[model samples]
Target chain A: MKSLDFFVYLFIMAGVTYLIRVLPFVIFKGKITNTFVKSFLFYVPYAVLGAMTFPAILFSTGNYAASAAGLAVACVLAFREKSLLTVAIFACAAALIVNLIAMAIQ
Target chain B: MKYFKKGLHDGIPIALGYVSVSFTFGLQAAGYGMYWWQAVLISLTNLTSAGQFAGLDIMVRGAGFWIEMACAQLTINLRYSLMSLSLSQKADKSLRGVHRWITGFGITDEIFAVAMGSNKDVSRHYMYGLILLPIIGWTLGTLLGAVAGQVLPEVIRNSLGIAIYGMFLAIIIPPSKKNHAVLKVVIIAALMSCVFKWLPLLSNVSSGFVIIICTVAAAAVGAVFFPVKEDSQ
Candidate 1:
């Protein structure tokens, strides 16, 4: 795509994201008193990340098996309270190994 | 200066994590044949993973869907609004005026977490220090990944695809391990996402909207059924 064309989309992404992040901080000076709103905000990040990760991760690699291996490794490490970098590196390493083994088998 | 130095100290892990995750994003952007600089620009401007990836898809394929792209970004990034609000309460007098806007611009998930974890009030200087390395790490990682992606072996490039999702799992999983409410929310959201992916009629929903629906539904369920205690923070 042309640089100009791509910038249009980039602008939209950045503009909207910055708006979301900035508006609340600038407008809401005091604490949010609503309980439901607060709880929803509290839980929404986990929900969004969870929805984005799964099913998507399963299809991220060359094949399902390799991706599954990656997912398994990631889940275990994450559940064990591993650092984000460690979980990420180990997951990719696991997927690569599975892909390499599959290639050898073929 | 002490607060600034402390912020930098606390930001080290987040910076390291962003490098690895954004490396995957850069690789993917390269796989899409983006110019290395263009990928870096996206990282520099947005500083988000899921939103950028989703936006890239629309930019490449669905050229005329700017509104869809905007909605997708808003939905995917809506949590930042919450994070920003939460941080606003912690803001000190130094966080007023244009400083608030600048500070808000840097409120990524990890940044917000580190800022909130601080027992002291958040200052503009502390935010500046906290945001500096991660932004640098994210953009540098993207530049390197995009450039290397052009010459790297296909297998390695493809295998790196899972790294971003791995980071996502890392972010959400540990919290879930500690809180049953969070665990249920994660499971419900994941299951809803799967249903939207596989079920006959729902399969036709656009990926962006699917995420929007799953997030709202799952989060609403969490709020209504398991409202967090007022003092829980």
Candidate 2:
């Protein structure tokens, strides 16, 4: 893509992103009292975040074994209530070590 | 000020994670022959993960895909709309139109996790504080990686990719552990997501649609079957 075209696309992307995020804030100025809507919205965070994480994450570390090791370590650490940064760093390190050892064996 | 300071403290992990995640983005953009400044500019303007990456993919496919790119971006980012809608209820009512509007701009997954997870209502000052570090780190990391492309070893780069997903898992696990409803919702959503990935017929569905379906479906199931029961413990 040309530089100008790229910029235009960026502008559009930003606009669309802004639109999705701002519309709710602008429109819903009060609490939502309907029990169904309330419960549905309450579950949104965990569902969305959980869906975003797994399966995709398992493939992120390039090698399946390494990704699994990293994922397992991260889960164990997170379940222990490790801080976010700690869990991420330790997981990444675990993946790295696993990847390196796998390569060394080859 | 108190909320703002706490927002900053809460944002630290996210900032660190963004720096790593966007670093890969920088690498990819640079690999595509993008100018370093252009990569930084994109990062500055678009504070989204999947959208920016999907947009980059469409850009690389080279021609006759602008419309496809836009649609792809819209779909990938559609999750943010859901997140913002959820956040709307948590925002402080004292916030003005401008504050609310600005708050919407930085509603990435990590930020949303921190904001929604907060015990108190999210305020404008706190939102700004929460957004500041991640934006700076995201832009700076992109610039550093794009300009200094190829400096990092492949091993390190690939390994750091785990940090982003690890961050995501970290965000959800605590809440799910605390609440069985949250646990069920997460498990159901994950199962649905896995079905989308492994089932050939369902695997044909685009990732964006898969996420949309799983999120809404799991949440709706939770709402119907297991509404929150309030009691003083």
Candidates' lDDT values, in order? Answer: 0.83, 0.84
Task: Provide TM-scores for the models.
Answer: 0.80, 0.94
> Tens digits of per-residue lDDT for model 1 on B1-233?
98788778766667766776688788888888888889999999999877888887887784678898889898778778867877887788888879888878899867886676566889988998899888888898788788875565767766877877877787887777778999999899999999999999999886766776887889899999999897785
Interface RMSD of each candidate, angstroms, one decimal: 3.1, 1.9
Q: Against the hidden true structure, what lDDT does model 2 obtain?
A: 0.84
**Model 1, runs deviating above 4 Å:** A1-13, B1-35, B50-79, B86-97, B109-130
Fraction of native contacts under 8 Å reproduced by each candidate: 0.80, 0.75
Cα error, candidate 2, residue B100 (Å): 1.1
**Model 2 C-alpha lDDT per residue in residues B54-86, reported as the tens digit of each score:** 788877776556677778877888888888888
Which segments of candidate 2 are over 4 A away from where they belong?
Answer: B61-66, B229-233
TM-score of model number 2, chain B: 0.92
lDDT at position B162, candidate 1 = 83
- DockQ numbers for every candidate? 0.60, 0.69
